[model samples]
Target: MGEQHGCQTCHGDTDAHVADPTMKNVLVYQAKGGSAVDELSAKCLACHDSDTHMAMWKMSKHSRNDISCFNCHTMHATRGAVDQPTKCFTCHRDIKVAVNKQSHHPIIENKIKCSDCHNTHGTATQHMIKDDTVNQLCYQCHAEKRGPFVWEHSPVEENCLICHSPHGSRHAKLLVEKVPNVCQDCHDWSRHPGTPYDANAGFTGSSPSNRFFARSCLNCHGAIHGSANFENHGLRQ
Candidate 1:
């Protein structure tokens, strides 16, 4: 049967298994005590090396970590392509939690797949991202943010991770921290650093000058990402 299907090409020397009909005689790619990861991966690469996506597998982080094809892929499985995330979530438990967060990409909704951002097989970019840079990868979907505005937020242009969390966050808009706190990371807050301005502060109308009244810094700096209008240098418009 191995020869009929050319399984031996990958399983290797299944002649002993054909003679003995036992697991011990067969080369199980993912068996706990069987061949080393390199030996197992070599079998997979032999057939997959020609694939454009898999071309970089040899240089991927997964390859360097001794992860084999069997680690993520299950041969002869009847599972659909959408089911792939379930296998990934098994190891990426942290990302599982992040995707479940209230504010997150539409991963759980199945509107998007992990492969949208990542080239799991391999990539020259860090984190196996499909694009050369994170911002470029994001621009694939958010073309609006791919702007050459007159006023630019330096960090927004440099790296999205500076203010936002790629996976998920408790804060709205996937912000790494809450509004004022996120802004305070770069802006100096010596004037009203730790002042507690809640609904009471606005209800009383006593501290209208406080920066923490409503949306905080965003109240004035509305165009936080960038602005097309030249007059909006403070990002207010």
Candidate 2:
């Protein structure tokens, strides 16, 4: 029906992605599935591969396991970076348990994702790091703890993982264990706050000892480092 009246069907505007500078290299559509693994490799190598830091993934455990970009990332889903954890949980069921443990990062309630802490794409450092060290990675959120304080807690600086679980924990404040005992592990009576102890006042099955050993160190040092305000009796306010 050449030049037919009321004919509405028509071709769209000319494709400009290839010709437009701003549109150059913009992803239009992504392939799917293992059948397209070669295509996926080629597509990824266009930006990644030997020339980039991400080339390490060519021989990584994930690569050996056949974990690819599309396996964890969706090109155009309602779930983006903010929901990446849920996407990861689709395969890693243990992550669900980890994120739900008693003391977890605010990921679930805040809708933050695993990618927020762990960089999956690429980085200049190992582990596809967004930061140089584990503490630095944690400091991205716990900036208050990254202090050059007058009194530095060794464990606090050495490895937070020792006392905290990055995924989660069963104890309050993300503690690795119940207190008094947990503190006693390193702070025995001999090293009472890091000093020699007197046998005369040695820790025995006394009333005072029971009082002191009944609860976690946090029961009294609730504020811990945050406890700067002390009462007249030298107790945390």
Candidate 3:
């Protein structure tokens, strides 16, 4: 069948010819056992060696774990467009469940794909992110949040993951925790180094717990991350 169907006809060429000899190292593969499965996989890797993104796959966790290129992608288009978490979920079911929860990065709704945020090929970072910094990667989509404002929340500028789960979140607004506690994380009343506040009485009276915590604190304190207003009092901006 190799001659009848012409392996070269379907697979293009299998000979070793290089456009750039310097990239010779990219053709590395394991076919030691030399079975049909191993040989076929090695054949697929031949042409893929020319792709720069695939070159980085060698250093990835998935590569180390024996995940091959065909695991998530369909070069031949047999499995349709290969829906995002659907492909990823095939291996990571638990994470898929979490990613399908209440709030997330829109991957579930197909607004974005996992490959948009992650490099299936290897990266300097463990998660295979395309960039060196996590926040920098997130800023590609949330450009509005990327700012050098006079008042900056350290975590917002640092890593969005500190407060949000990039894949999915159970809480509203993609927060790791609910509002008041989420704000209280770094901005505890005691730790407000700018202008101190009274935490002695935790909202008593008939005021609803959720309303008091959510609005009262954030409303008066217009800018949770310290305002630039020169005339501002404590938090009454």
Candidate 4:
């Protein structure tokens, strides 16, 4: 915040970054490079710890998890030399895998950023999410799903994560699981006698094969996310 100068101000004794300034005493954040995570972040925080957004740094998830400023921000590079996405993926490989699946947010395409839905700096919400709840964050992009509908799906009314995977999914709609399986999580309790929705019980066997194919649940319950209808049993758009 004040007049700051020289690499030594942040790096603190350039020789320390070097294992020996001559040999192997220097520490590395990676298998071989730079310094320790705590040292680096502490140095940065010594200068920046007073900032408004950084007020919660002491209690932040990243701080507690040993994440340093360099984890997301690079020093001594051109303005945009580093890619935040790749840096983020380094720690969150699980999310990296999820986003690469068939259906996902447009993060890889650069239409979205990890920071778009997450503060990453600090937040009161779990996962450092920017909103009070997952559904609230999702409603920023999917306002249609935030309906005060005439009929509400129980899980949908509760949490979007119950039916959807926010990162990505192999399923067509970022669904947590496949369609009927997603529906079956709730609807499997009740069924008629001698007429099951399994692989062998529909219209002379042809019905089961065709009707219960991929996303058969959606074919009937087209408005699965939610529907505003007062008729048709409230499962329509």
Best by TM-score: 1
Candidate 1, 1-237: lDDT as tens digits: 223456677677788778877656445766484778887877777666667546788799988988888888776676585376687898799999998887898888888888889988889999999998999998888888878888888888999989988988888999998977787777655643545656655545335455433335775678877898867754574
Q: How far off is residue 101 in model 4, in Å?
A: 1.0
TM-score of each: 0.83, 0.62, 0.68, 0.77
Off by over 4 Å in 2: 1-39, 47-56, 59-61, 75-82, 122-129, 189-216, 219-237
The list of candidate 4 runs beyond 4 A from truth reads 1-4, 13-36, 49-53, 191-215
Candidate 2 on 29-115: residue-level lDDT in tens? 344322344345545554444544365656654565666666766544565564666776787787689779978887789667777
Error of 1 at 174 (Å): 0.4
lDDT of 2 at 128: 56
lDDT value for candidate 3?
Answer: 0.63
**Residue-level lDDT for 82 in candidate 4:** 60
Error of 3 at 126 (Å): 2.7
* Alpha carbon deviation, residue 237, candidate 3 (Å): 4.7
Score candidate 4 by TM-score against the native: 0.77
